[model samples]
Structures are given as structure tokens and as C-alpha cells.
Target: MENDTICAISTPIGTGGISIVRMSGSNALAIAFKIFSSKNVSQESIKPRYFYLGNIHTADVNEKCMMVYFKAPYSYTGEDLVEFQCHGGVLVTQKVLQSLIESGARIAQGGEFTKRAFVNGKLSLDEAEGVIDVINAESESELKASYGLLKGNLHKEVEKLQNIITDILSEINVTFDFPENDDEEVTSADVLEKLTRAQKTLDHIIKTSTTGLKLKTGTKVVIVGKPNVGKSSVMNAMLGTDRAIVTSIQGTTRDVLEETYIYKGVKFNLIDTAGLHDSNDLVESIGINKAKEILKNADIVLFVVDGSQELDNFDKDIIKLLNDKKVIVVVNKCDLKQKINSSILPHAEHMECSALENKGITEIKDKIYNMVIDEKVLSQNVIITNIRHAEALSKSNEIILRVITDLQAGANLELVSLNLQSAWETLGLITGVSGTEEIIANIFSKFCVGK
Candidate 1:
């Protein structure tokens, strides 16, 4: 299957300025030349990486297009690659893909191109994941983290740690083969010191997962408050669009409203739930219950309160619900005469805002971002954004810790070598060096076709 020519519509299948149909394999250029006709270019004369204007000759339709080729060993998949930039439209792209398929190019599966790259040693497993992350990134922070992976930041660090292990393993092997030589025998102290360093490196990388995950998956910011407290308005003000209904009448929003916005390169998922209060209406009551449920799972709760009105039983009731949650007490309606005391919500960070006038919204965004994401952690170039990488790193760390324990307990060097080798292979999984076919298939299955 890896030897066959593969093709797919690389660009999104919809109307746009242009859409690219990509192909890679030994027959990529042959398949492209079979269907594409250019005035001055032939398969023998077409230069690699140079674009040529041409007409796509299919059975029923002919369309003007542009074509480019990448020679083998220099292309994205390290094989002969070709791309046809056709007029952007649903039918046009599909027809182009079909034309290629009819011309002996097999349809590329989801992430097949990238999978080929990984198989050809063009990318590490983590770097291939980074390519997908870059494609699906929702915010600047996500893009930065994914780009770091594409640039081989995490791979470099992992390689360094693996090198340390390799050195120790080599010494252990020599010690076993030549017990008579004292210099070749690796001492427990020497192994412990090197393993401890590797452990610290792994620990630091694992710690970044907390903030790294938030960057990849936006922070969940749920808005909860008494009715008509500008909860919906605050959501609108933050989003710069009126996504939720806002009315002077209480209980206007009877269900949860959700929207997402990017602030300072970080994505924030704003969920405006039904106001927290006692209600007789069955639907509103259900929504209130759901709001309470969502509150428990929120990354940060924006407890909105109408500053124009004094703290009432409804406000107090909601405040008590935010027991140990990471919360920001949003005293909305600050333009009106202040009546609600911020000091009442002692458990949360307090900020005043006038959603109607769009005042203090920036401060709210900054505070939320600062509260959740640590700038210091993000400053570190390598972060594990993918959960799989984190899991593998954690397992490798555990194995290394066990090896340390065995050494400390005066276990045999041969047994210690076995654990060390296991740790090395576990780390290799992150780079695809020791990953099974099933794991690799599952990882690529999450990718969209044409990736």
C-alpha cells in the first residue's frame, strides 16, 4: 500500500479562490501527466517545484488549472509529489480528484499523506501530531505550541533524555560482558545520578501538560448569576457580538447559551447558562439545574451580579454554590449606582463591568487568562499538547522511577538493564520508533482525509 500512488483534494472541498489536489508516490508525476495538458510542458520537461498552467483532460469535462511537482526524496512524503490547483468549487475539486483516481492514483485515506511522511522518516510521531494541531488550532497559543512540535522541540528534548539512557545502557552492557574490568562496570551511584537527571526532565515536561492542554482545548468559562444580572450582556461584550438574548425582564434566557472567543492568543469557551434562581416553570427549572451541574465542571466560573441592585437572597444563594471553584465575581451594571458589595464574594477574584457600555471587558479577559495560564510555563518551548504524548511520557517516567528503585535496592544489573530498556522503548513510542501498527493507525484515524 505504501508503494502505490496516493491522491486526495488537499484543500477544503468548497468554493474558494483555489483548491489543491495532491498526489505522492513513484507514479505521482505519471498519473498527473496522464490527465493534465500544458502548452509548453511535458512529463519529461516539467521541472520539480515549478508551477505549470495546464488544462485537466477528463472523460467528460476539461478545466484549466495549475500544476506543480516535487521530485522524490525532496517532497513532503519524501516521494515524487504533484499538486493541481483547480478552480475552487465543490464539483470542480471532486471532478479533479475523480480524474486523478481514474488515472491510476488511489484515494488517500485520512492522514495518509502524513502517515507516509512518518513512515518515510520525514517526521517524528510528535511532529506529525503537531501538523494536525496546526491545522486544527483555534487560537494563537495553540498555534505556537503546535508549531513548536513541528519544529522538533519536544523530539529534541526526548532525544537528549534517550541519549542519556543509551549511554547508561551501553555501560551496563559492557559491565555484564566484562565483569573482570572495574572501569567498564557501571556503578549504582553513576546510574542513579543520570536517571535522576532524566526523571527531572520528564517531570518538567509533564508539568506543562496542564497549561498545554488548556491551550489546545480552550478554557471553559461558565457565566452564572441571578436573572437579569447582565450575564448574557457580559458574554456579548466579551465576544464582541450579541450571541445571547438580553432582556430587562427576568428569566429571559431559559436555556444555556454558548460561544467561543480568542483573547490574547488563548481560546475561551464562554457558556452563558440560565440564571441561577428558584422558578416554577418546568423548562426554566431544568435549565437552572443544568446550570448547577455545569458549574461543578467549569474551569473558571464568572459569577455575575447586578451592581445596581443590593445583594439579595438569589445572589447569596449563588455565591454559596461557588464553594471552592476558581471564580471571578463579575459585578455587572457598574454604570448604574453601585449597591452590591464586592467584599461579600470573598472566595473569588472581583472585577466590575458595564456590559451595556462595554466597560472593563478587557480587564475581565486579562484576569481570566492570567488566572488560568501561567506565562512562565508557556515560555518553555517544549510542551506536551497531545494527551497520548503525556500518557507515554508518564509511563516512561514510571519505568525510570522503578529502575531507580531497583538500583537502590541492590537489584541485579541484568534486571536493571531490562527495566532501562523498557523505559527506552516507552519513550520511543512518542517518536513512533517503537509504536505498534494499531496505535499508529488509531492516531491517524482522528485526522481528516487529505491531511
Candidate 2:
């Protein structure tokens, strides 16, 4: 561990009942003794992991507070650590941190503490990233995926794959070392079989990323259709709130309205766009154009139509755009007599609903949730939410495939082993076992100061 002591406010710097100033390093205990004194424990008698009621005597003020200490090799940073629980006010926490800094503790950079923990072998690279995800998570599903990473399951799986490659490489090397050891003779078929199986396992992981990425970045679901199709009513019904301006008049919503809702633990960005139609008015034209633009980029498009009215040219034009798109034809206003024939819609099963009655709204939500989330992978808890890990896994899988091909072509075992070594190193990028300092620094730089 580094010898320089680092300190920061571990809690949010705002009004609360309590705030913590954390310090970690070899000199943390020495620095704490300079400003904090408790009669219950002396410098030599201070117990590790024991709380001590103390008074922080600074030049500006002598504030009474509580302190706790943790010895090296067992703390969060795997070094000596101390925490001072002070008043929750911003000034109080800042003064406490400044006092520690004046006493020889330097301010911690963003995520230095967790980075040190990684350096000290307390966590893998992916697990450290999980820590960040947990802190910034907005939904239960995001938190669940983050916890999976933090729990080290993904690291363990990668380690197993790496070990398989390592064993194969060792077997290949043994054949080169002892040519007469016929039992050690590794056949190309054997190597190909093992690598192929590993490739399949890795491929499944990458496949889940299609939906896994959505867990981190909420799915973009835009509800669009012609004017007076009850698009705003659908948005309100889905959100269970009067978010968008609901009016019977056509083109009332002359702009895109966006709101977020959690469905079955996954987060979704439900966007209600202006009615898509030919517009002579300038502002409505702008909104219509904007809706068309975003519709091109949406993950899911809810093509709503009024069941009480037949499809018009405006609806046909919008349908032209919905082709080759992931769409749900919402034949809204099912409470009235149904006149719209949903069979004419080319894509997706048309969902009939009355937005005013809130009928079928729950079913629409269920279908939306089911469209993007892969329940099997989420149930297995092996989602690849992090883009970095996904890319690394992909690179490794590609390298392994090339190795399999070279082996099948009767290439020399030495050449095959070299490609396998590359695959191993690539997988190591996710775990930090064989990563460069630049990647590590870049990852940690994104974390908050206290973590």
C-alpha cells in the first residue's frame, strides 16, 4: 500500500444527521492522534475497529465527535484507516477533513480508496466497477446486476475460462519439452474441442449484452402516431400519472414529452412524441419533424391508432416508417366501438386498449418489459452490463476462435499457444490480474472521491 495518507468526506456533503471523514494509509493513526483525543483509549491502547468518543481540537473550533480505527491488511483499503463521525453540516465536515490534512493527511482523489483496495487484492477490476454501479444505480434491476458484478461471480467464471486455456497451453508445452512422452502428446482434435466449448460459453455471455446494456441505459421507447390518436392518454396511462397534457384536440402535444418508469425492476424511458402528420403550422411542423427523427433511433416504437377511426393517409405514412422496426401497434380507445382492423398492421401483435379507461395498460407495460429484458440471463445473474467487460470478453472469444482454426489446420502447437496466451491476457483485462496501469487509472478516475 502507498505510504501517503488520504482523507475525504465519506458521506454526502450536505445537511444530514451525520457525516464521516475517512482517512486511510500507514500514517492515518498518527494523523488522527494529532487532532483527536479520547480518554477511553490512549495512543498505545487504541483498539482496532473500536469506536472512541473524542474531541477534534482545531484552531477554529474544538468540536466533540466520535472516531473509529481499523488496522492494516483488514480495512477497506487494506491499510490503516480511521473515520471521524462529525456533525452533518458542510462546514463541520470540511473543517474536520482540513484538520486531518493539516495533520499530514492529504486529500484523496476520486476513487483512490477503492483503487487502493484493488491494488491490495481486496477486489477484482469488475467488482470495483460494480461498487461504482451500486452507488449510481437508479433501479432495482440495475442494482441487482451491479451486485452480481460486485459479488465476483463474473470474475470467477472468467478465471475458470483462463485456467482452461492455461492448462491447455501447459499440455502443449509438455509435448514440445518431451517429444517421446506419447501420453503427453496433445492432439489437434482435443485442443479444438476444448476451445470450441469455451467459445460457446463466452458467446452466450456476449449475446445477453443486447438486453444487458439496456439495464444500464434505460430502453428508449417512443410512442408515436397520427394526430388525435390518444397518444398523450397512452403516455399518462402507462406512467399512472397526468404527465403529458391530455386533450381531445389534435396536435395538443406539439413537443416530445419524456418520463421514466420502473417496470418489473427494469427502468424505461417512455417518450410521448407529437402526433406524426402533415402540418402547415410552423411549431407543429418542427415537433413532427423532431418526432420522426427520434423515431429513427428508438428501441421500441408504440404505433398507436384510434380504434374508433379507420386508418388514414397520415397513419399510412407513419406505418411506412414502422416497417423493419420493433413496433407495437396500440389500437387505442377500445372502450368505444372498434372500427380499426389491426390485421392490416404488418408488424407486432396489435394491443387493443382504452387509455381513458386504463384497460390493457398493465398488459402493455408487461409486453414492453418483456420485449427488451432477457429473463433467463437475468435469472442466472450473469449479465454483461459493463461495456468494457463485454468488449474484453468478445476479444478473448475471437482470439480463441482463431486459435481453434489454426489448430484444426495442423498449425504448430507453439503458434497456437501464442494465440491462446493472447486470449488469456485479454480475459485478464476484466479482472485486473494482468492489466496495464493506464486502464486501471482510467477506470478509477471515474469514481467518486469517498469510494
Q: How many residue pairs clash in each candidate?
A: 0, 0
In model 2, the Cα lDDT at residue 381 comes to 63
TM-score of 2: 0.95
Off by over 4 Å in 1: none
TM-score between model 1 and native: 0.94
Backbone clash total, candidate 1: 0
Which ranges in model 2 have alpha carbons more than 4 Å from their true place?
Answer: 1-3
Query: What overall lDDT goes with each candidate model?
Result: 0.91, 0.91
TM-scores vs. true structure, each candidate: 0.94, 0.95
User: Model 2: which residue pairs collide?
Assistant: none
Per-residue CA lDDT of model 2 for 119-190, tens digit only, reads 999999999999999998989988998999999979998998999999999999999999999998998888
Tens digits of per-residue lDDT, candidate 1, 1-451, equal 6779999988887799999899999999989989999997999999998999999988866999999999989989998999998899889899889988998999999999999999999999999999999999989889999999999999998899899999999999999889999977789899999999999999999999988888988899999999999999999999999899999999988888888899888888999999888899999999999999889989999999889888889988998899889999999999999987648667779999999999999999999999879888887899778889999899999999998988899988788888889888999999988979999999888788888
Number of residue pairs clashing in candidate 2, backbone atoms closer than 3 angstroms, sequence gap of 3 or more or interchain: 0
